[model samples]
Target: MEHQTIKRIAAFSDGGQGGNPAGVLIAETLPGEAEMQRIAAEVGYSETAFLAPHEDGWRVRYFAPEIEVPFCGHATIAAGAALAEQFGGGRYRLYLNNGDISVEGEIQQSLAAASLQSPPTRSEPVPEALLAEALALFGWHESDLDTRLPPAMAYGGASHLILPVRHRATLKAMQYDQAQGKALMEAHGITTFCLVHAESPTRFHARNPFAIGGVYEDPATGAAAAALGGYLRDRQWPHHGEVEIIQGEDMGARSLLRIQISDQPGGSIRVSGTARTIS
Candidate 1:
């Protein structure tokens, strides 16, 4: 079957220097698994989101170069922006493999911003063995960890291992063998390894190793950022109920993410940022 290959633009940055890059593929009918994977691999972004017409909205699926993820926020934001630009600014509901989520795209004059609400979030304690393996993979010692945050596998739409480091330097100097890390992540059902360091009460630095996605690192990770916010809310971290994440600086791409947590139980946290089109 022939399908129209829509334009794919990288979002959430200025000149595509920062933020996670995603592939936005729009088609009338969904492609098969093998074909979708091929397209995603050719696109070669951290994640590629496929959108097809549904009853009233759209059905979306996110695929890394190698695997299909339950959901990907950066890709969703990028797709939303693409759709808004194509069909005009509005809200889009997406039916994902994991659950239903929505993204709203707005154009203020010439400036555009997109916000995505992630799936319900929850976190589980990181197993000691898993933590140790991850630490060894990154060549990090236990002293490098931020004890207050502890270690946990958090999930918003996809599962991520949150490893908070005590210092920015430690977070910056992270390294691992891509093949080995990918094997481990695939084996453990991990989408990304989120490395973070608190710079202040409300400011943080982040790095995401996305070996399983065929990327060395992500400049910005929306799903991971949401997961982190949910994790902090769950722990009642000593914050003012909001946080800003700066990522990709170490790689010279520089991305920004803003997260807001409410007092209500099981509330939908807000993840907002600016996205610029990258040709």
Candidate 2:
């Protein structure tokens, strides 16, 4: 196989300072699955995106260190940034393993602005059995959860267990055993643990633990953000149309994600962020 050059970009950056890093590779042809996994592991980011020209638009695949995700938001944003640099700023259609989505990218001085239309979102009340295990993993009790946003399983391309806390302090003190988290997540097909605290109807704080992906945490998680937006819309949370999330501050990365929700339930949510090339 020919060597492919990887571009490292930080997606959802806050003023070009902090964000989640992702590796992006644009090749003439998509590499084999095994090779993509190896490259993603070697790159050692939360996720890596591979893109190749397809019959209509483009083929996109996301790989974590341990597995291939159906879709990944931060990596998609990073890929969009790369695409803009290479093919000019515009919207790019992407065909994923399970569905099709689009990402718009445009150069903004030293950074890039990217937005992704996620797959239709949905959420269901979490099973009692799974919720018990998740609470134990985080040493959180049911009372710790925000009554407004009950525990639920949310999906935006990938599945995430949403655990909205009542206080921001709870989000700041998030921790868990990586091995145990990985085991539980894998067993339940959960991609990440989306920990959140709502500052207001339109503002939130988040911390996503992606142990299933062999990542302790993600500074910025676009998929989870989109999923949360959908979940909130489902519950009729007073979002007023959009919500701004501040994530990774407790991790020192301080990333930001903006999610736009439509009136239609289970509709596609738009996740927007900025990307900066990693020097």
Task: Evaluate all candidate structures by whole-model CA lDDT and list the values in order.
Answer: 0.84, 0.95
Model 1, residue 205: distance off in Å is 0.6
Model 1: runs farther than 4 Å from truth? 1-4, 14-16, 108-111
Model 1 Cα lDDT, one tens digit per residue, 230-255: 88888888769889889888998888
lDDT for each residue of candidate 2 in 246-270, tens digit (9 for 90 to 100): 9989999999899999979789999
Candidate number with greatest lDDT: 2
TM-score of model 2 vs. true structure: 0.98
The window of 10 residues in a row where model 2 has the poorest summed lDDT is 1-10
- Screening candidate 1 with a backbone cut-off below 3 angstroms (N, C-alpha, C), the clashing residue pairs are 12-275
- Mind sharing the TM-score for model 1? 0.94
The deviation in Å at residue 46 for candidate 1 is 0.9
**Model 1 alpha-carbon miss at residue 74, Å:** 0.5
Cα lDDT over the full model 2:
0.95
- As for candidate 2, its clashing pairs are none
